[model samples]
Target: MQLTHFNASAKAGVSRASSRRTTVRVQAAAARPSWFPGNKLPEHLDGTLVGDFGFDPLGLGVDKDKLRWYQQAELVHARFAMLGAAGILVPDLFHQIGAGGPAAQIPWYDHAKFEYYAPINALFGVQVLLFAWAELRRLQDIRNPGSVNQDPIFSQYRCVCACV
Candidate 1:
């Protein structure tokens, strides 16, 4: 037997050579980064899949600025990373609702862990930010005569290790 798949545009199922070609084209397209500058929203999340009542994990309706992954990470760090060290293990209620939607709908706080909680969550994807924060703290602490800065907020923001 042979595998077969639908060719939606043709309104029929395709197999063998034609199917293989379509599959190849699709795979190639998928591999490429589709992001184009000036896009108002992410292609992956267009607010159609989940419907209006549901939440789009990648697409946020309120914020018009479409940011790259790095920009999103930076925004997360600037807004909440230090707070993690300040003892806010869970993100604020507004954050939970805004980025990922209601907790009952999806675990927004859990998802924000990587962005808001640095170093510990660094390995997940925000290593550069964590490294920068750690390095800055290390330099500051060196002159301040403490292993980490004495400031309540800054001290909490210090990385687990000084070496980064």
Candidate 2:
């Protein structure tokens, strides 16, 4: 009933206590931010970037080029939105104060009704053309930085105000 293997091993000087023990050193994992407990902070968004709190929930700006484009698009959209807000407010304010003649009296919502007029339609067409051209130029600028500024058509006008 006695274990002879233990006695035999002990007799041979093969003790478990005498065996070499290996130690594994494991590094501690980085701490996750409190706000994004469920997700890892995007590696691309290092703290060096201005206003970068690593808050890209949708991962839309994963690519740096697309991120730059998105930033530019946001700026353009914001500027247009400001202009649109002013376009609505200025006329409405003028109308409320009985100023700016018959044009201001026409509410912004009703302006679409006058689109059928030849002059308005022409103006709309011109605006659409201008917007399309500007957007193409912006896209070009994004794809090839400084391309827009070098355009012959636009470059000629750059010094138009120099005389003043």
Candidate 3:
């Protein structure tokens, strides 16, 4: 004797209850992770990013565009910091090894006291201006990607000056 819901009311009631339970389970499974029961992880961070561990306590990086911008900014800052470290270390290392001449004798801190000739000063000014222009162009590129045709080989006049 098999017990079946032959009655229309009984079948409808059972189906509704099961469907409701399944819906709730699906929502719970999709939203919250097992480790963090309190906070529901955002749907966007699906553990695919470089360092994504799904640990967004502050709820930052919710916007995809802002997140990408932040990532790029971090990379740029990190690269600059590495360059600064190298800049400090290389001169000091050369000084310690007794390789460099008069310039190396001056410690990194006291290098500001060293006087430069007019030509050198002019060159430094030109370098600063060129760096500023490049930085502005890079900033524009970041703000509007593909806006600056940064093709080093095939840029304006095809001279490859930008690559240098």
Candidate 4:
């Protein structure tokens, strides 16, 4: 089961439910269970749809509340890490690399490149996710969790101070 980021020309027929997290939501279209919030993104292996993973046997089963927090943090942390790494790769976010790309994928050049930052990015990304999950759990512990009781994305992207 290879994980891909995009769908293929054949499976492009899948529609976005504006709710799913990966492309596997297509398999459940016939049932449309209430637990799954259809995701628009498609999961493919090198642009080919082998099949939907629905709930893969990789032991990904987790508490939705906990997952929501982790996913949000993961998204933000990825953005920041990409920004930081891209800063190392191409300081200018808008800059492009001269190679095969849709132009949008091109990257400028990074001036102060770090040899160890690659590993650092991976470590930091995981740390950010764990921290966000802990924060959410902490908030849930409060007698009155307050306004932070918003959507997962909100809790994840909200300013750290805003967590109050």
Q: Best by TM-score, which number?
A: 2
Those runs of model 2 whose alpha carbons end farther than 4 Å from true positions after fitting are: 1-39, 48-51, 115-124, 150-164
For model 3, the stretches where C-alpha displacement exceeds 4 angstroms are 1-42, 55-58, 116-132, 150-155, 158-164
Instruction: Kindly list the per-residue Cα lDDT of model 3 for residues 36-107, writing each as its tens digit.
Output: 666566777886677665676666788888887777778888998999988778888888999777777788
By lDDT, the best candidate is 2
TM-score of each: 0.18, 0.60, 0.52, 0.27
RMSD of 1: 19.0
Model 1 lDDT on a 0 to 1 scale: 0.47
Model 3 Cα shift for residue 32 (angstroms): 12
Instruction: For residues 117-146, write the lDDT of model 4, one tens digit per residue.
Output: 467779789999998887666556443554
Lowest lDDT sum, 10 consecutive residues, model 4, at 41-50
Give RMSD to native, each candidate: 19.0, 14.1, 11.5, 21.1
Backbone Cα, N, C clashes tallied per candidate:
0, 0, 0, 6
Clashing residue pairs found in predicted model 3: none
On the 0 to 100 scale, the lDDT of residue 28 in model 3 is 32
The true-versus-predicted C-alpha distance at residue 133 of model 2, in Å, is 0.4
